[model samples]
Structure formats: C-alpha cells, structure tokens
Target: MEPGARAVPATLHTLRKNIDSIPQGVQSVVEQFSVPRQQIISDLNNVSHSIGFTIHSLLKEQVYSVLEAIQGRAQDLQNSLHHLQILHKTVRTLTHFQDELGLALRDRKESTVSLLDSPHCTSCARALGKAQSLEPGADYSRVPSVEQVLKTLSGLPKANFPDLIDQGNSTFNSMPDLAVAKMAQVVQDLKDEVNKVSKKVQSIADSFPVSDYTQPLNDALMQAENKSRPYLQEVKHYEKYRWIVGIVLCSVVLLVVACNLLGLSLGACGLAMREDPSDYESRGEAGAKFLLVGVGFSFLFSWLLILLVFATFLVGGNVQTLVCKNWANQEIYKFIDTPGNLPPSTNLTQLLNLKRTLNLTSAYQECKKGAGLWDVLQLRDAYDLEDHLHLSQYTRDFQKRLDNFNLHFEEIHFLDGAGRRDLETFRQSGIDQLDYPMFQAEMQNPVVRTSLEDLARDLEGLRKIQRNITIAGRLANESQALWKIQNATVLTQEALVVKLNESVQFLSAMAPHLQLLLKQTMAEIALIETMLPVQAQRLLRHEIGCFTRKELGYFSQYLNWVRRTLTEDVASCQPLATALDNGRVILCDRIAEPWLYCLRGDLSLPHPPRYSSQAIGRGLRHLQDSDSR
Candidate 1:
C-alpha cells in the first residue's frame, strides 16, 4: 500500500514526459476528440501534480513516520541481539582474572597481607571496573551463562587470558599491602605535629598580654564554637548483588543443559541397560567408525532444519555486534547482569563459638568490590546529594579559618621582628649621628614592603582557593576516587589545608616576642578567632578536610597505577567488546544471506541478482580448490 503511494510522484513525472513526447499526428487526433478544451495536456499535467502532492503528504505523515519508528526499534533490537555474547566474553575474562587473583591472594595470605581483603584491592577493582566499563555489582545481573561465553570463545581469536591474569597478578603484587601500618604511621606523624603546634600556641598564651589580648581571644573562640553546624550527610549505598554473578553464570549453564537433555539421559540409561559401552570397544575401530557415521547421518536427516536455525543465529548475533555501533558505551551498559557471591575474607577473624553471627553493618548485601565511574558520569542531576557527602562544602570553609588564624599568628611575629630591627636602628642612629651612609641605606631598604607583599601573596593564595573550588568535588561519595580527585574542589581544599599546616609550628614558637606585638595586634588575633570558628563550624569542617585527604592518599596511589597500566589495561578490556564484532564482516565475505523480511512483514527468500549466486558459488569452489592444494 505504501509502495503504491510512493509510486504516485514517479507516475506523475512519467506522465508529464509522455504528454511532451506525443507526436504531431497523435496531438491533432487528440485535439479533435477534446476540441472544447484549452491546453488539455497542461490541464492534465496540473491534475497529475495535484494528485501526487496529496498522496506524498499523506504517506509522509501516516506511513513513512510509523515505518521509520518501527525500523528504528528493529535496528536497536538487532544491535542488542548479541548482548548475551558480550556478557559471555566478560564472564570468561573476569572469571579467569578473579581465579588468578584469588589464588595469588591465598598464597600471600599465609605470609603477610591478603590482597583479597584489603581496601586497596577494592581500589584496584574500582579501576578495572571503570577501564572495562563494567560495574561489578551493578552489572552482575547482565552477565551471560558460562555456556554462552564458551560458545563465543570457540569463535573468538584466542583472548590474552595469560596476559590478563598476569596483569591482575602484577597489579596486586605492586599494591602496598601494609595499609594499616601506613595509616598508623600517618596518624603518628599528625600527632607529633599537633603536639608541637599545641605547645607553641600554649606558650604564646602564657604571656599573651593577659589584661588586653587574652580576653579578646577567648571571646573569639566562644563566638566561633557557638556557631551551628550542618548535619553529617552520607551516601545511600545501593544493594550490591555482586556475589551472585558468578553463581548465576554457572547455574545458567547447568539449568539450560539439564532442562534440554533430560530425555537424552533417560534414553542413554535404557541403551546402557541393553548393552554396556564395553561391548562397543570389543569391536574394531572400523566398526566403531561405521556406528558413528550411521548415528551422524540419522541425526543429520532428523534435524536438517537446524542448519537454517544456526544460520539465523549467526546472522542475528553478527548484526548485534556490528563494528560501526557504539556497543561499548551502549549495549554493554544496558542490561543488569546476574550477581556473584563474594568469598569470605581470608583476613577476617572468625569466631570459633557463637550462637548467632554478629552483623555489624546493614551493608551485608553490599559487594566487596568498588563501584565503577560509569555511574557517576551518567547521573542526570547537576549536583545530586546521593553523589556527595555533606563534608564537601564544609572542608574549604574550615581551611579558610585555618588560613586566617595562621596569617594573624604569623603577622604578629613578623611585625615584631621588623619592629625590633627598626627600634635598634633608631637607637644606633642616635649614637652615631654622623653615619650618613647607614641612614641612607636604611631609606633604600625594602624590608617592610617585602614583608607586606609576602603577606598579600599568601592571602591571595587563600583567596584563589575558593575561586577554583567547585560543587562537584565535595560530593565524591561513591565515585571512582581516582577520577574524582580531578574535581577542583577536592584539589583546592587539600592544598589549603596543607598550606595552613606548613608554618603552624614555626609561627607558634614566637610567643615571648609576640607579647609586645600581641597588645599591638590584639585586634588581628581577635578578628581571626571570631571568623575562623564561625565560618568553619568551629572545628568539624576543618577536620573533615583532614580526614578526607587521608583517604585521598589511597586514591592517589590508584591513579599512579592507572597511569602506569593504562595501555595494558586498555588492551586487556578491548577484546570483550570487539570479539564478536568481526563475526558480521567474516559472514558477509564467506556466507550467503539467503533470507530476508519482505515489505509485507513475512519471511521470504531474497531474489538473487543476475548471475550473482553463480559468481558466489564459483568463489566458494575456487577457495575450496586452493585450500585442498
């Protein structure tokens, strides 16, 4: 029906040519028959165009649009047809990689740290997941059966399974196993610095112009501490069905095979009862070959239809994995694969005696593996609360407070240093009234100017901190920690905290000298205290930045790893998406496309072009002849 509608415009164009081509004899004969009409041919041409336009517009809206939509859907289904195969390849790769890792971890568990149990393993898993575009727990439900994957493997050019396993092994071996020790060392270092800083701050407090400055400092602390703090916000962790993924893959193979072959098993049992397989071995190899051939020929004729069935499978599978399609980002992420079971931690201490197991966290269903980066990039929200913690916004404000305090504390000492030199110079000038060169040199000195400029530059560094900071950073709740560090907010906050802490101990040691300056700079001290605690929620916000960076230490290590292994990692992950894509190209060159869907939505054999099939047949014969030689 739609084809006929499309034909209207072409028919009208043909009619126009026909009217123009009429010979003079035919025109005069037609003129006598239509003598009453003026320019009959032109009138007929106009009518034909009008009919063509109406048919064209009607079909454009009612027919072509609907067909286009249907075609689009068919294209999507065709592309996604090989989704199972992709999952299959992934299952094989991950299974191989996981087994190797698990074994290597077991070997190490007896000696030192178990890679299987460490948070660092979680970090590695996170990176591997992103690099491969698979969210372990989130994507488990989409994993195909071991059988399906094995089928795909049979057709694949052998994957670099050894290389993948070696990479996994190397990655784990390269990982720093003594994370606890490192954390302990970091904590100890922070403690030493804190203690040293506290003593200096306390000494300054001792002779801190008690009557004039001490009261103002206390008032500032009080004001800052009294400020209200925001509630601590945490990410809502999704239930990870990761552990079931491997189990589901194995179970699929079993269930599918079991359901299909139960009758075969029963028939085999009946045959065994009649005669054991020992009877067949009693005969010669020739007798056995004869028996196998008879069975093959019988099954061949019985299931001759399966050839076309398998051909359809080939066509369908190849279409789904078309090389031009972006299945890596699209189809790979579409379905949720079945989850896998997580093995019990080798490092975890199990109680020998217990009435019931103690559950420490509601995240029992959570997979041990880390989430991937794909989820973070795919969210629709500009700044979803789910993506970040409350501490993100609070960190920078805390750093600002620290900066203000440091500036005031250091400024007082700096001014005192400059003042002492100035006072001594004045006394010397009085003693040596004839020293004109010394006085002239003093006029040329830029001591105060340099000091003021340094202060401004340091203050400007603090100013630039917030300007570079962004909202996206503070919220890397469940993100790929390695990638999340790129956020300006995270970097800026970290920089500010480190900078503020750098001069803390040195500035604190100037208590005795600061006594004179304290009275002079009391307002500077007062202003810092008042602003620091109030804007930063007193101490909590600053501590949040400190705590966050401690974890960032782990993220940094992972980023270093990715940099080193990026090429290898890309090579490792590329095979699964590309494995089956070549199926179509190979088929188009070697196999014949015999069937197609007709316009009427029914299956039909395609009409061959003139001598096309004969040429293809000849190509196949010539290829066979060459192979035989």
Candidate 2:
C-alpha cells in the first residue's frame, strides 16, 4: 500500500502527459475543417479586393475622367462654335460694308479720297477688330446636345469600393477567431474533466484503509515486552530444572535395563563354558547375583518412576489443554486482557498513555479477524492517516496544470453592420446604369461637326467679290484673324477628343468584366454569410467536442478503475489471517501436540522395565542350574 501510494503521483504524471496532448488533438480536429473554410474565406476576401480595384479602375480611370474630359471638351466646342458663329456674322456684316464701300468708291472719284478715309472700309476695319477682340463664352445654346451629355455624366452616383473591400476582408478574417474561441472552450471543458478525474482518484486514494494507530500500538507492545523481561527470565530458570528432572527420571529406567542386559549376557556365557554352579567365582553365580540386584533395583524405583510419570502427565496434559489450546485459538489473550490479570505497569492502555480503553483480547481478536492493524490497535483518536495522504494537493496541481491548455488564434471579424452596409452600397453603385454605347458614340464623334478653318476660308473668298482695295484687304485680315481662333480651338479640342477616346475604349472593354466581378463578389459574400458559421459550428461540436469527450471518458475510466480496485481488492486482509492460522498450526499442532504425545508415552512405558528385570532373574537361575550339571 505504501508503494501504491508512492506510485499515485507518477500515475497522475502519466495522466498529465495524456491530458497535455488534448490540445494537439483538438487542433488536429479543428484543422480538418478550419483550414479549408479559412481558405475559402480568404478567396472571398481576394474577390472583394479585386472588385474594389476594378470599381476604382472603371470610376477613376475610365468613367469619371472620361466624362469630365468629354464635358470639358464639349464646353470648348460650344465656345468655339459660338465664337465662329459670331465671327461669321461679324465677317458677313463686314462683307456687306465692303460691298457698299466698293459701290460708293465706284460712284465717287477713284483717287479723290484715301482708302483708309472711306467710311465703309473704316467701319469694316473697326468691326473686324472688335470681332477679333471678342472673348469666347460657354454658350450652351450653341451645343444643346453636348450640354445634356455633360449633365447626364455629372449626375452619376459614386461608390465607396475601398471601404467595401475592407469590410468583407474583416468579416472573413473574424471566422478564425470564432473557431479559436470554440477550440478554447473544448480545451477548458476537457481540463475541467481532467480535474474532476484527478479529484476522484484522490478521493479513492484517501479511502485506502490506512491508519495512524499502529505506531502507538507498537509502542505499547514494546513497553509490554520490556515489562515482561523478569517473568521471561524466571521461566528460563524453571526450564533448566525441568530438563534435570527429565534426565533423572529417564536414568532410573536406564539403570534397570543395563542390569538386565548384563545378567543375560553373563548367564549365556556361563552355560556355554560349562562352569560349576558351586564355585563362587563362576560366571553363572555372578549372573544370578546380578539378576537379583536388577530385580531389587526395579522393585525399589517402580513407585518413584510412577510418581514422576504421573506428575509429568498431569503437568503436560494441563498445559497442552489450558495454555497451548487457548493460545492456538487466541483465547489466552482474554485471560491476559482481564483487569488486574497483569500488573498495572504492564497494562497496554497505561503504557500508551491513551484515554481510550485498551483491550488486548479485543485487539488480538480483531487482528485474527483480519481487521487492519491500525484499527485493531485502536489509534483512531491519536492519528488520522487519511489527513496525511495529501490527495487534495495532487488534485490541485493537476487542476493547475490543466489550465495551461488553450487554442492559439489571431483576430478575425464577422460581417458587422458597417460591413453589410458597405457591401450593399457597392452592389447598388449604378455602374450598369451608365450608357456605355452612348458614351462610346459621343467619344467617337469629333469635337465640332463643321470645320472652323473652312468657315474662315469661306470668309476669305469674300475678298474676291470685293473690287474696292480697302474692302478686299479688310476681308483678308478678318479671315486671317478667324483662322487663328479656329486653329487654337481645334488643337485643344482634338487633344480632349484623344483622351476621351482612350477612356471610352477602356470602359467598353471593362464593362462585361466589371459586371462579372460584381456578381462574383456578391456570390462570395453570400457564401461567407451562409457557410462559414455552419462549418465553424460543426468543427466545434463534432470534431473538437467529440475528441474532448473521448479523452475525458478514458480519464474517467482510469480513475474509476483505480477506485474500484483500491476499495475492493486492495482492502482484503485474508492473507494476514491465513498467516495467523499458519502460526497457530506451528504452535499447537507442531510443538504442543508432540509434547503431549511424549507425556502419554512416558506414562504407558513404566511397567516394562520392572517386568524385564524379573524375567532376567528367572533366566539367571536357569543358567545356574544348567551349569551345575
């Protein structure tokens, strides 16, 4: 039992080793499902990020820039077109003035007045200068169709793609955290089970049949032994006298036997030698005398031998029946345990200085009945071995170690309200609403339908119709001024058209992919919303929880088995009782029974020596008679 107590801690250590592996088991189970789900969530986040990137590309690089560029260029075209209209009107009016100048000059003297001095030519020059000085205004009336296009583009709604992508990524990332929390719960529950099992084992260990009474009882027995020294010495002294009396009693019979055997030998030798019976020195005469002496000795010691045998029989029989029998059956302990049966100094209770009444008979009977020595010795009030087992300490340490297991994890997010809102906003962003075909058609169109340079050339042709030198010169100058304005407007509008065309081509190419990306991103969001939680739940319940329960089951079984074995099997004291029975056999059957049989034989054998002596006397006389012949 002491060895078993020592082994308990090591056994608990072994249990601890098994418990420590639970986290690894949980992780293995968690990984079976979590890894794949995590990968899917990651893929969804990538899809969301891609959608944001595509949206940004379409809005910033394709749609917004293109529309803004188109609006700016359309405004330029309107201004240029309006300026050309004003220039044409101004040029037409100048042409009319020039024509009137030519008509008036023809009617007037050819060299009578200077060309610069002519009122019509002077008026035309002033009008042309004013037309050239005219700053272009943004006239929507000149290009009503383009103004409508700009308004439509400007009215398009904006979407927050970056925020949507972040929301989706955060939502997917939080799944791993939830899974870890579930795993932590598994570990903690398993630890709780481990602690419970440890406590159970400790409880069983405490229940082991151990007591502290043995020590005090042993001390009492030792004191009794010390007190018994003088009595044991007195018995040893009496045993020496007993050996002397036994030898003296055996010698009386041996003396008679020696005389008988010698007489017989002498008588036989005399007969063989044919000795004369009358001769005093003859062997026959000596044989007769020796036989008579043997008879005399036998007659003299018969009653003494009877008395010794009778005494030995009475003493041995009484001791065997009273002492050995009682000792064998453990009944002698009763006699010794009676009050005043022994000296007070030899009393077990007095020696132990204990308040509880001590009973030697009861203690011995209890021991013979296979009660634990501690309980038989009556040490319950003196000490509690149960308190010394320290089972709670083992369980406490086990529980403390159990606390070390936990599932490792990083932060993750499930979709929150903000994320859902962002996703909805992304879904509803009106990318599909924009008319790609219309934008494409508009970009494909030139900034102006009619060439301003052609208009300027048409104005230059007006000089041919004018015969007056001043009128033709004024028309040529006006045409050159209109040509300069057209050149600048055309260059700026052409650059805007080139940028707009690139943007339109990009948007046109991305349109189908953008729609597909949006659909795919939405599908991924739905998958995360519907599938991730279920997978996590299954992992926590089926895999991790099952594994935890299995480990706990094994742990409980071990503790219960230990408890059962200790309580039922280890508690039996049958072996001790068997040993005590063997001791009884050794004392009563082997030792006392043989001594009683020997006493019986001594009583039955006394007359044989007397009879043998008489027969020897008869033999001796017959030998004398034969020798005389």
- Tell me, by TM-score, which candidate is best: 2
Tens digit of lDDT per residue, candidate 2, span 1-629?
12222333333343333333333432333233333334433433343233333323332332233233323333333433343334334333433433443343233212212322355543334333233323322221232123333333332223333443455455444444444443445344544544454444444334332323224433443455455455456656777887897687678677777777887677677767664555423776676667676777778878887776677567667767897788766787677777887887787655533336446655555545655434543344544544533334334443343334333323222334554453344334443344557655544544334444654564466566666777778667656655654564545545544554454455445445554554554455455446544543443334433433433344444444433332233332234344445545545565556657776663444454344656665765676466556
Candidate 2, TM-score vs. the true structure?
Answer: 0.39
Q: How much is the lDDT of residue 532 in candidate 2?
A: 42
Model 1 RMSD, rounded to 1 decimal: 57.6
Task: Give the local distance difference test score of model 1.
Answer: 0.30
Model 1: ten consecutive residues of lowest lDDT = 228-237
Writing each residue's lDDT as its tens digit, candidate 1 over 499-601 gives 3223222222332333343233334434433543243233323443444464333323433443223213311212212322333333332222222232124
What is the TM-score of each predicted model, taking all chains together?
Answer: 0.15, 0.39
lDDT of 1 at 385: 25
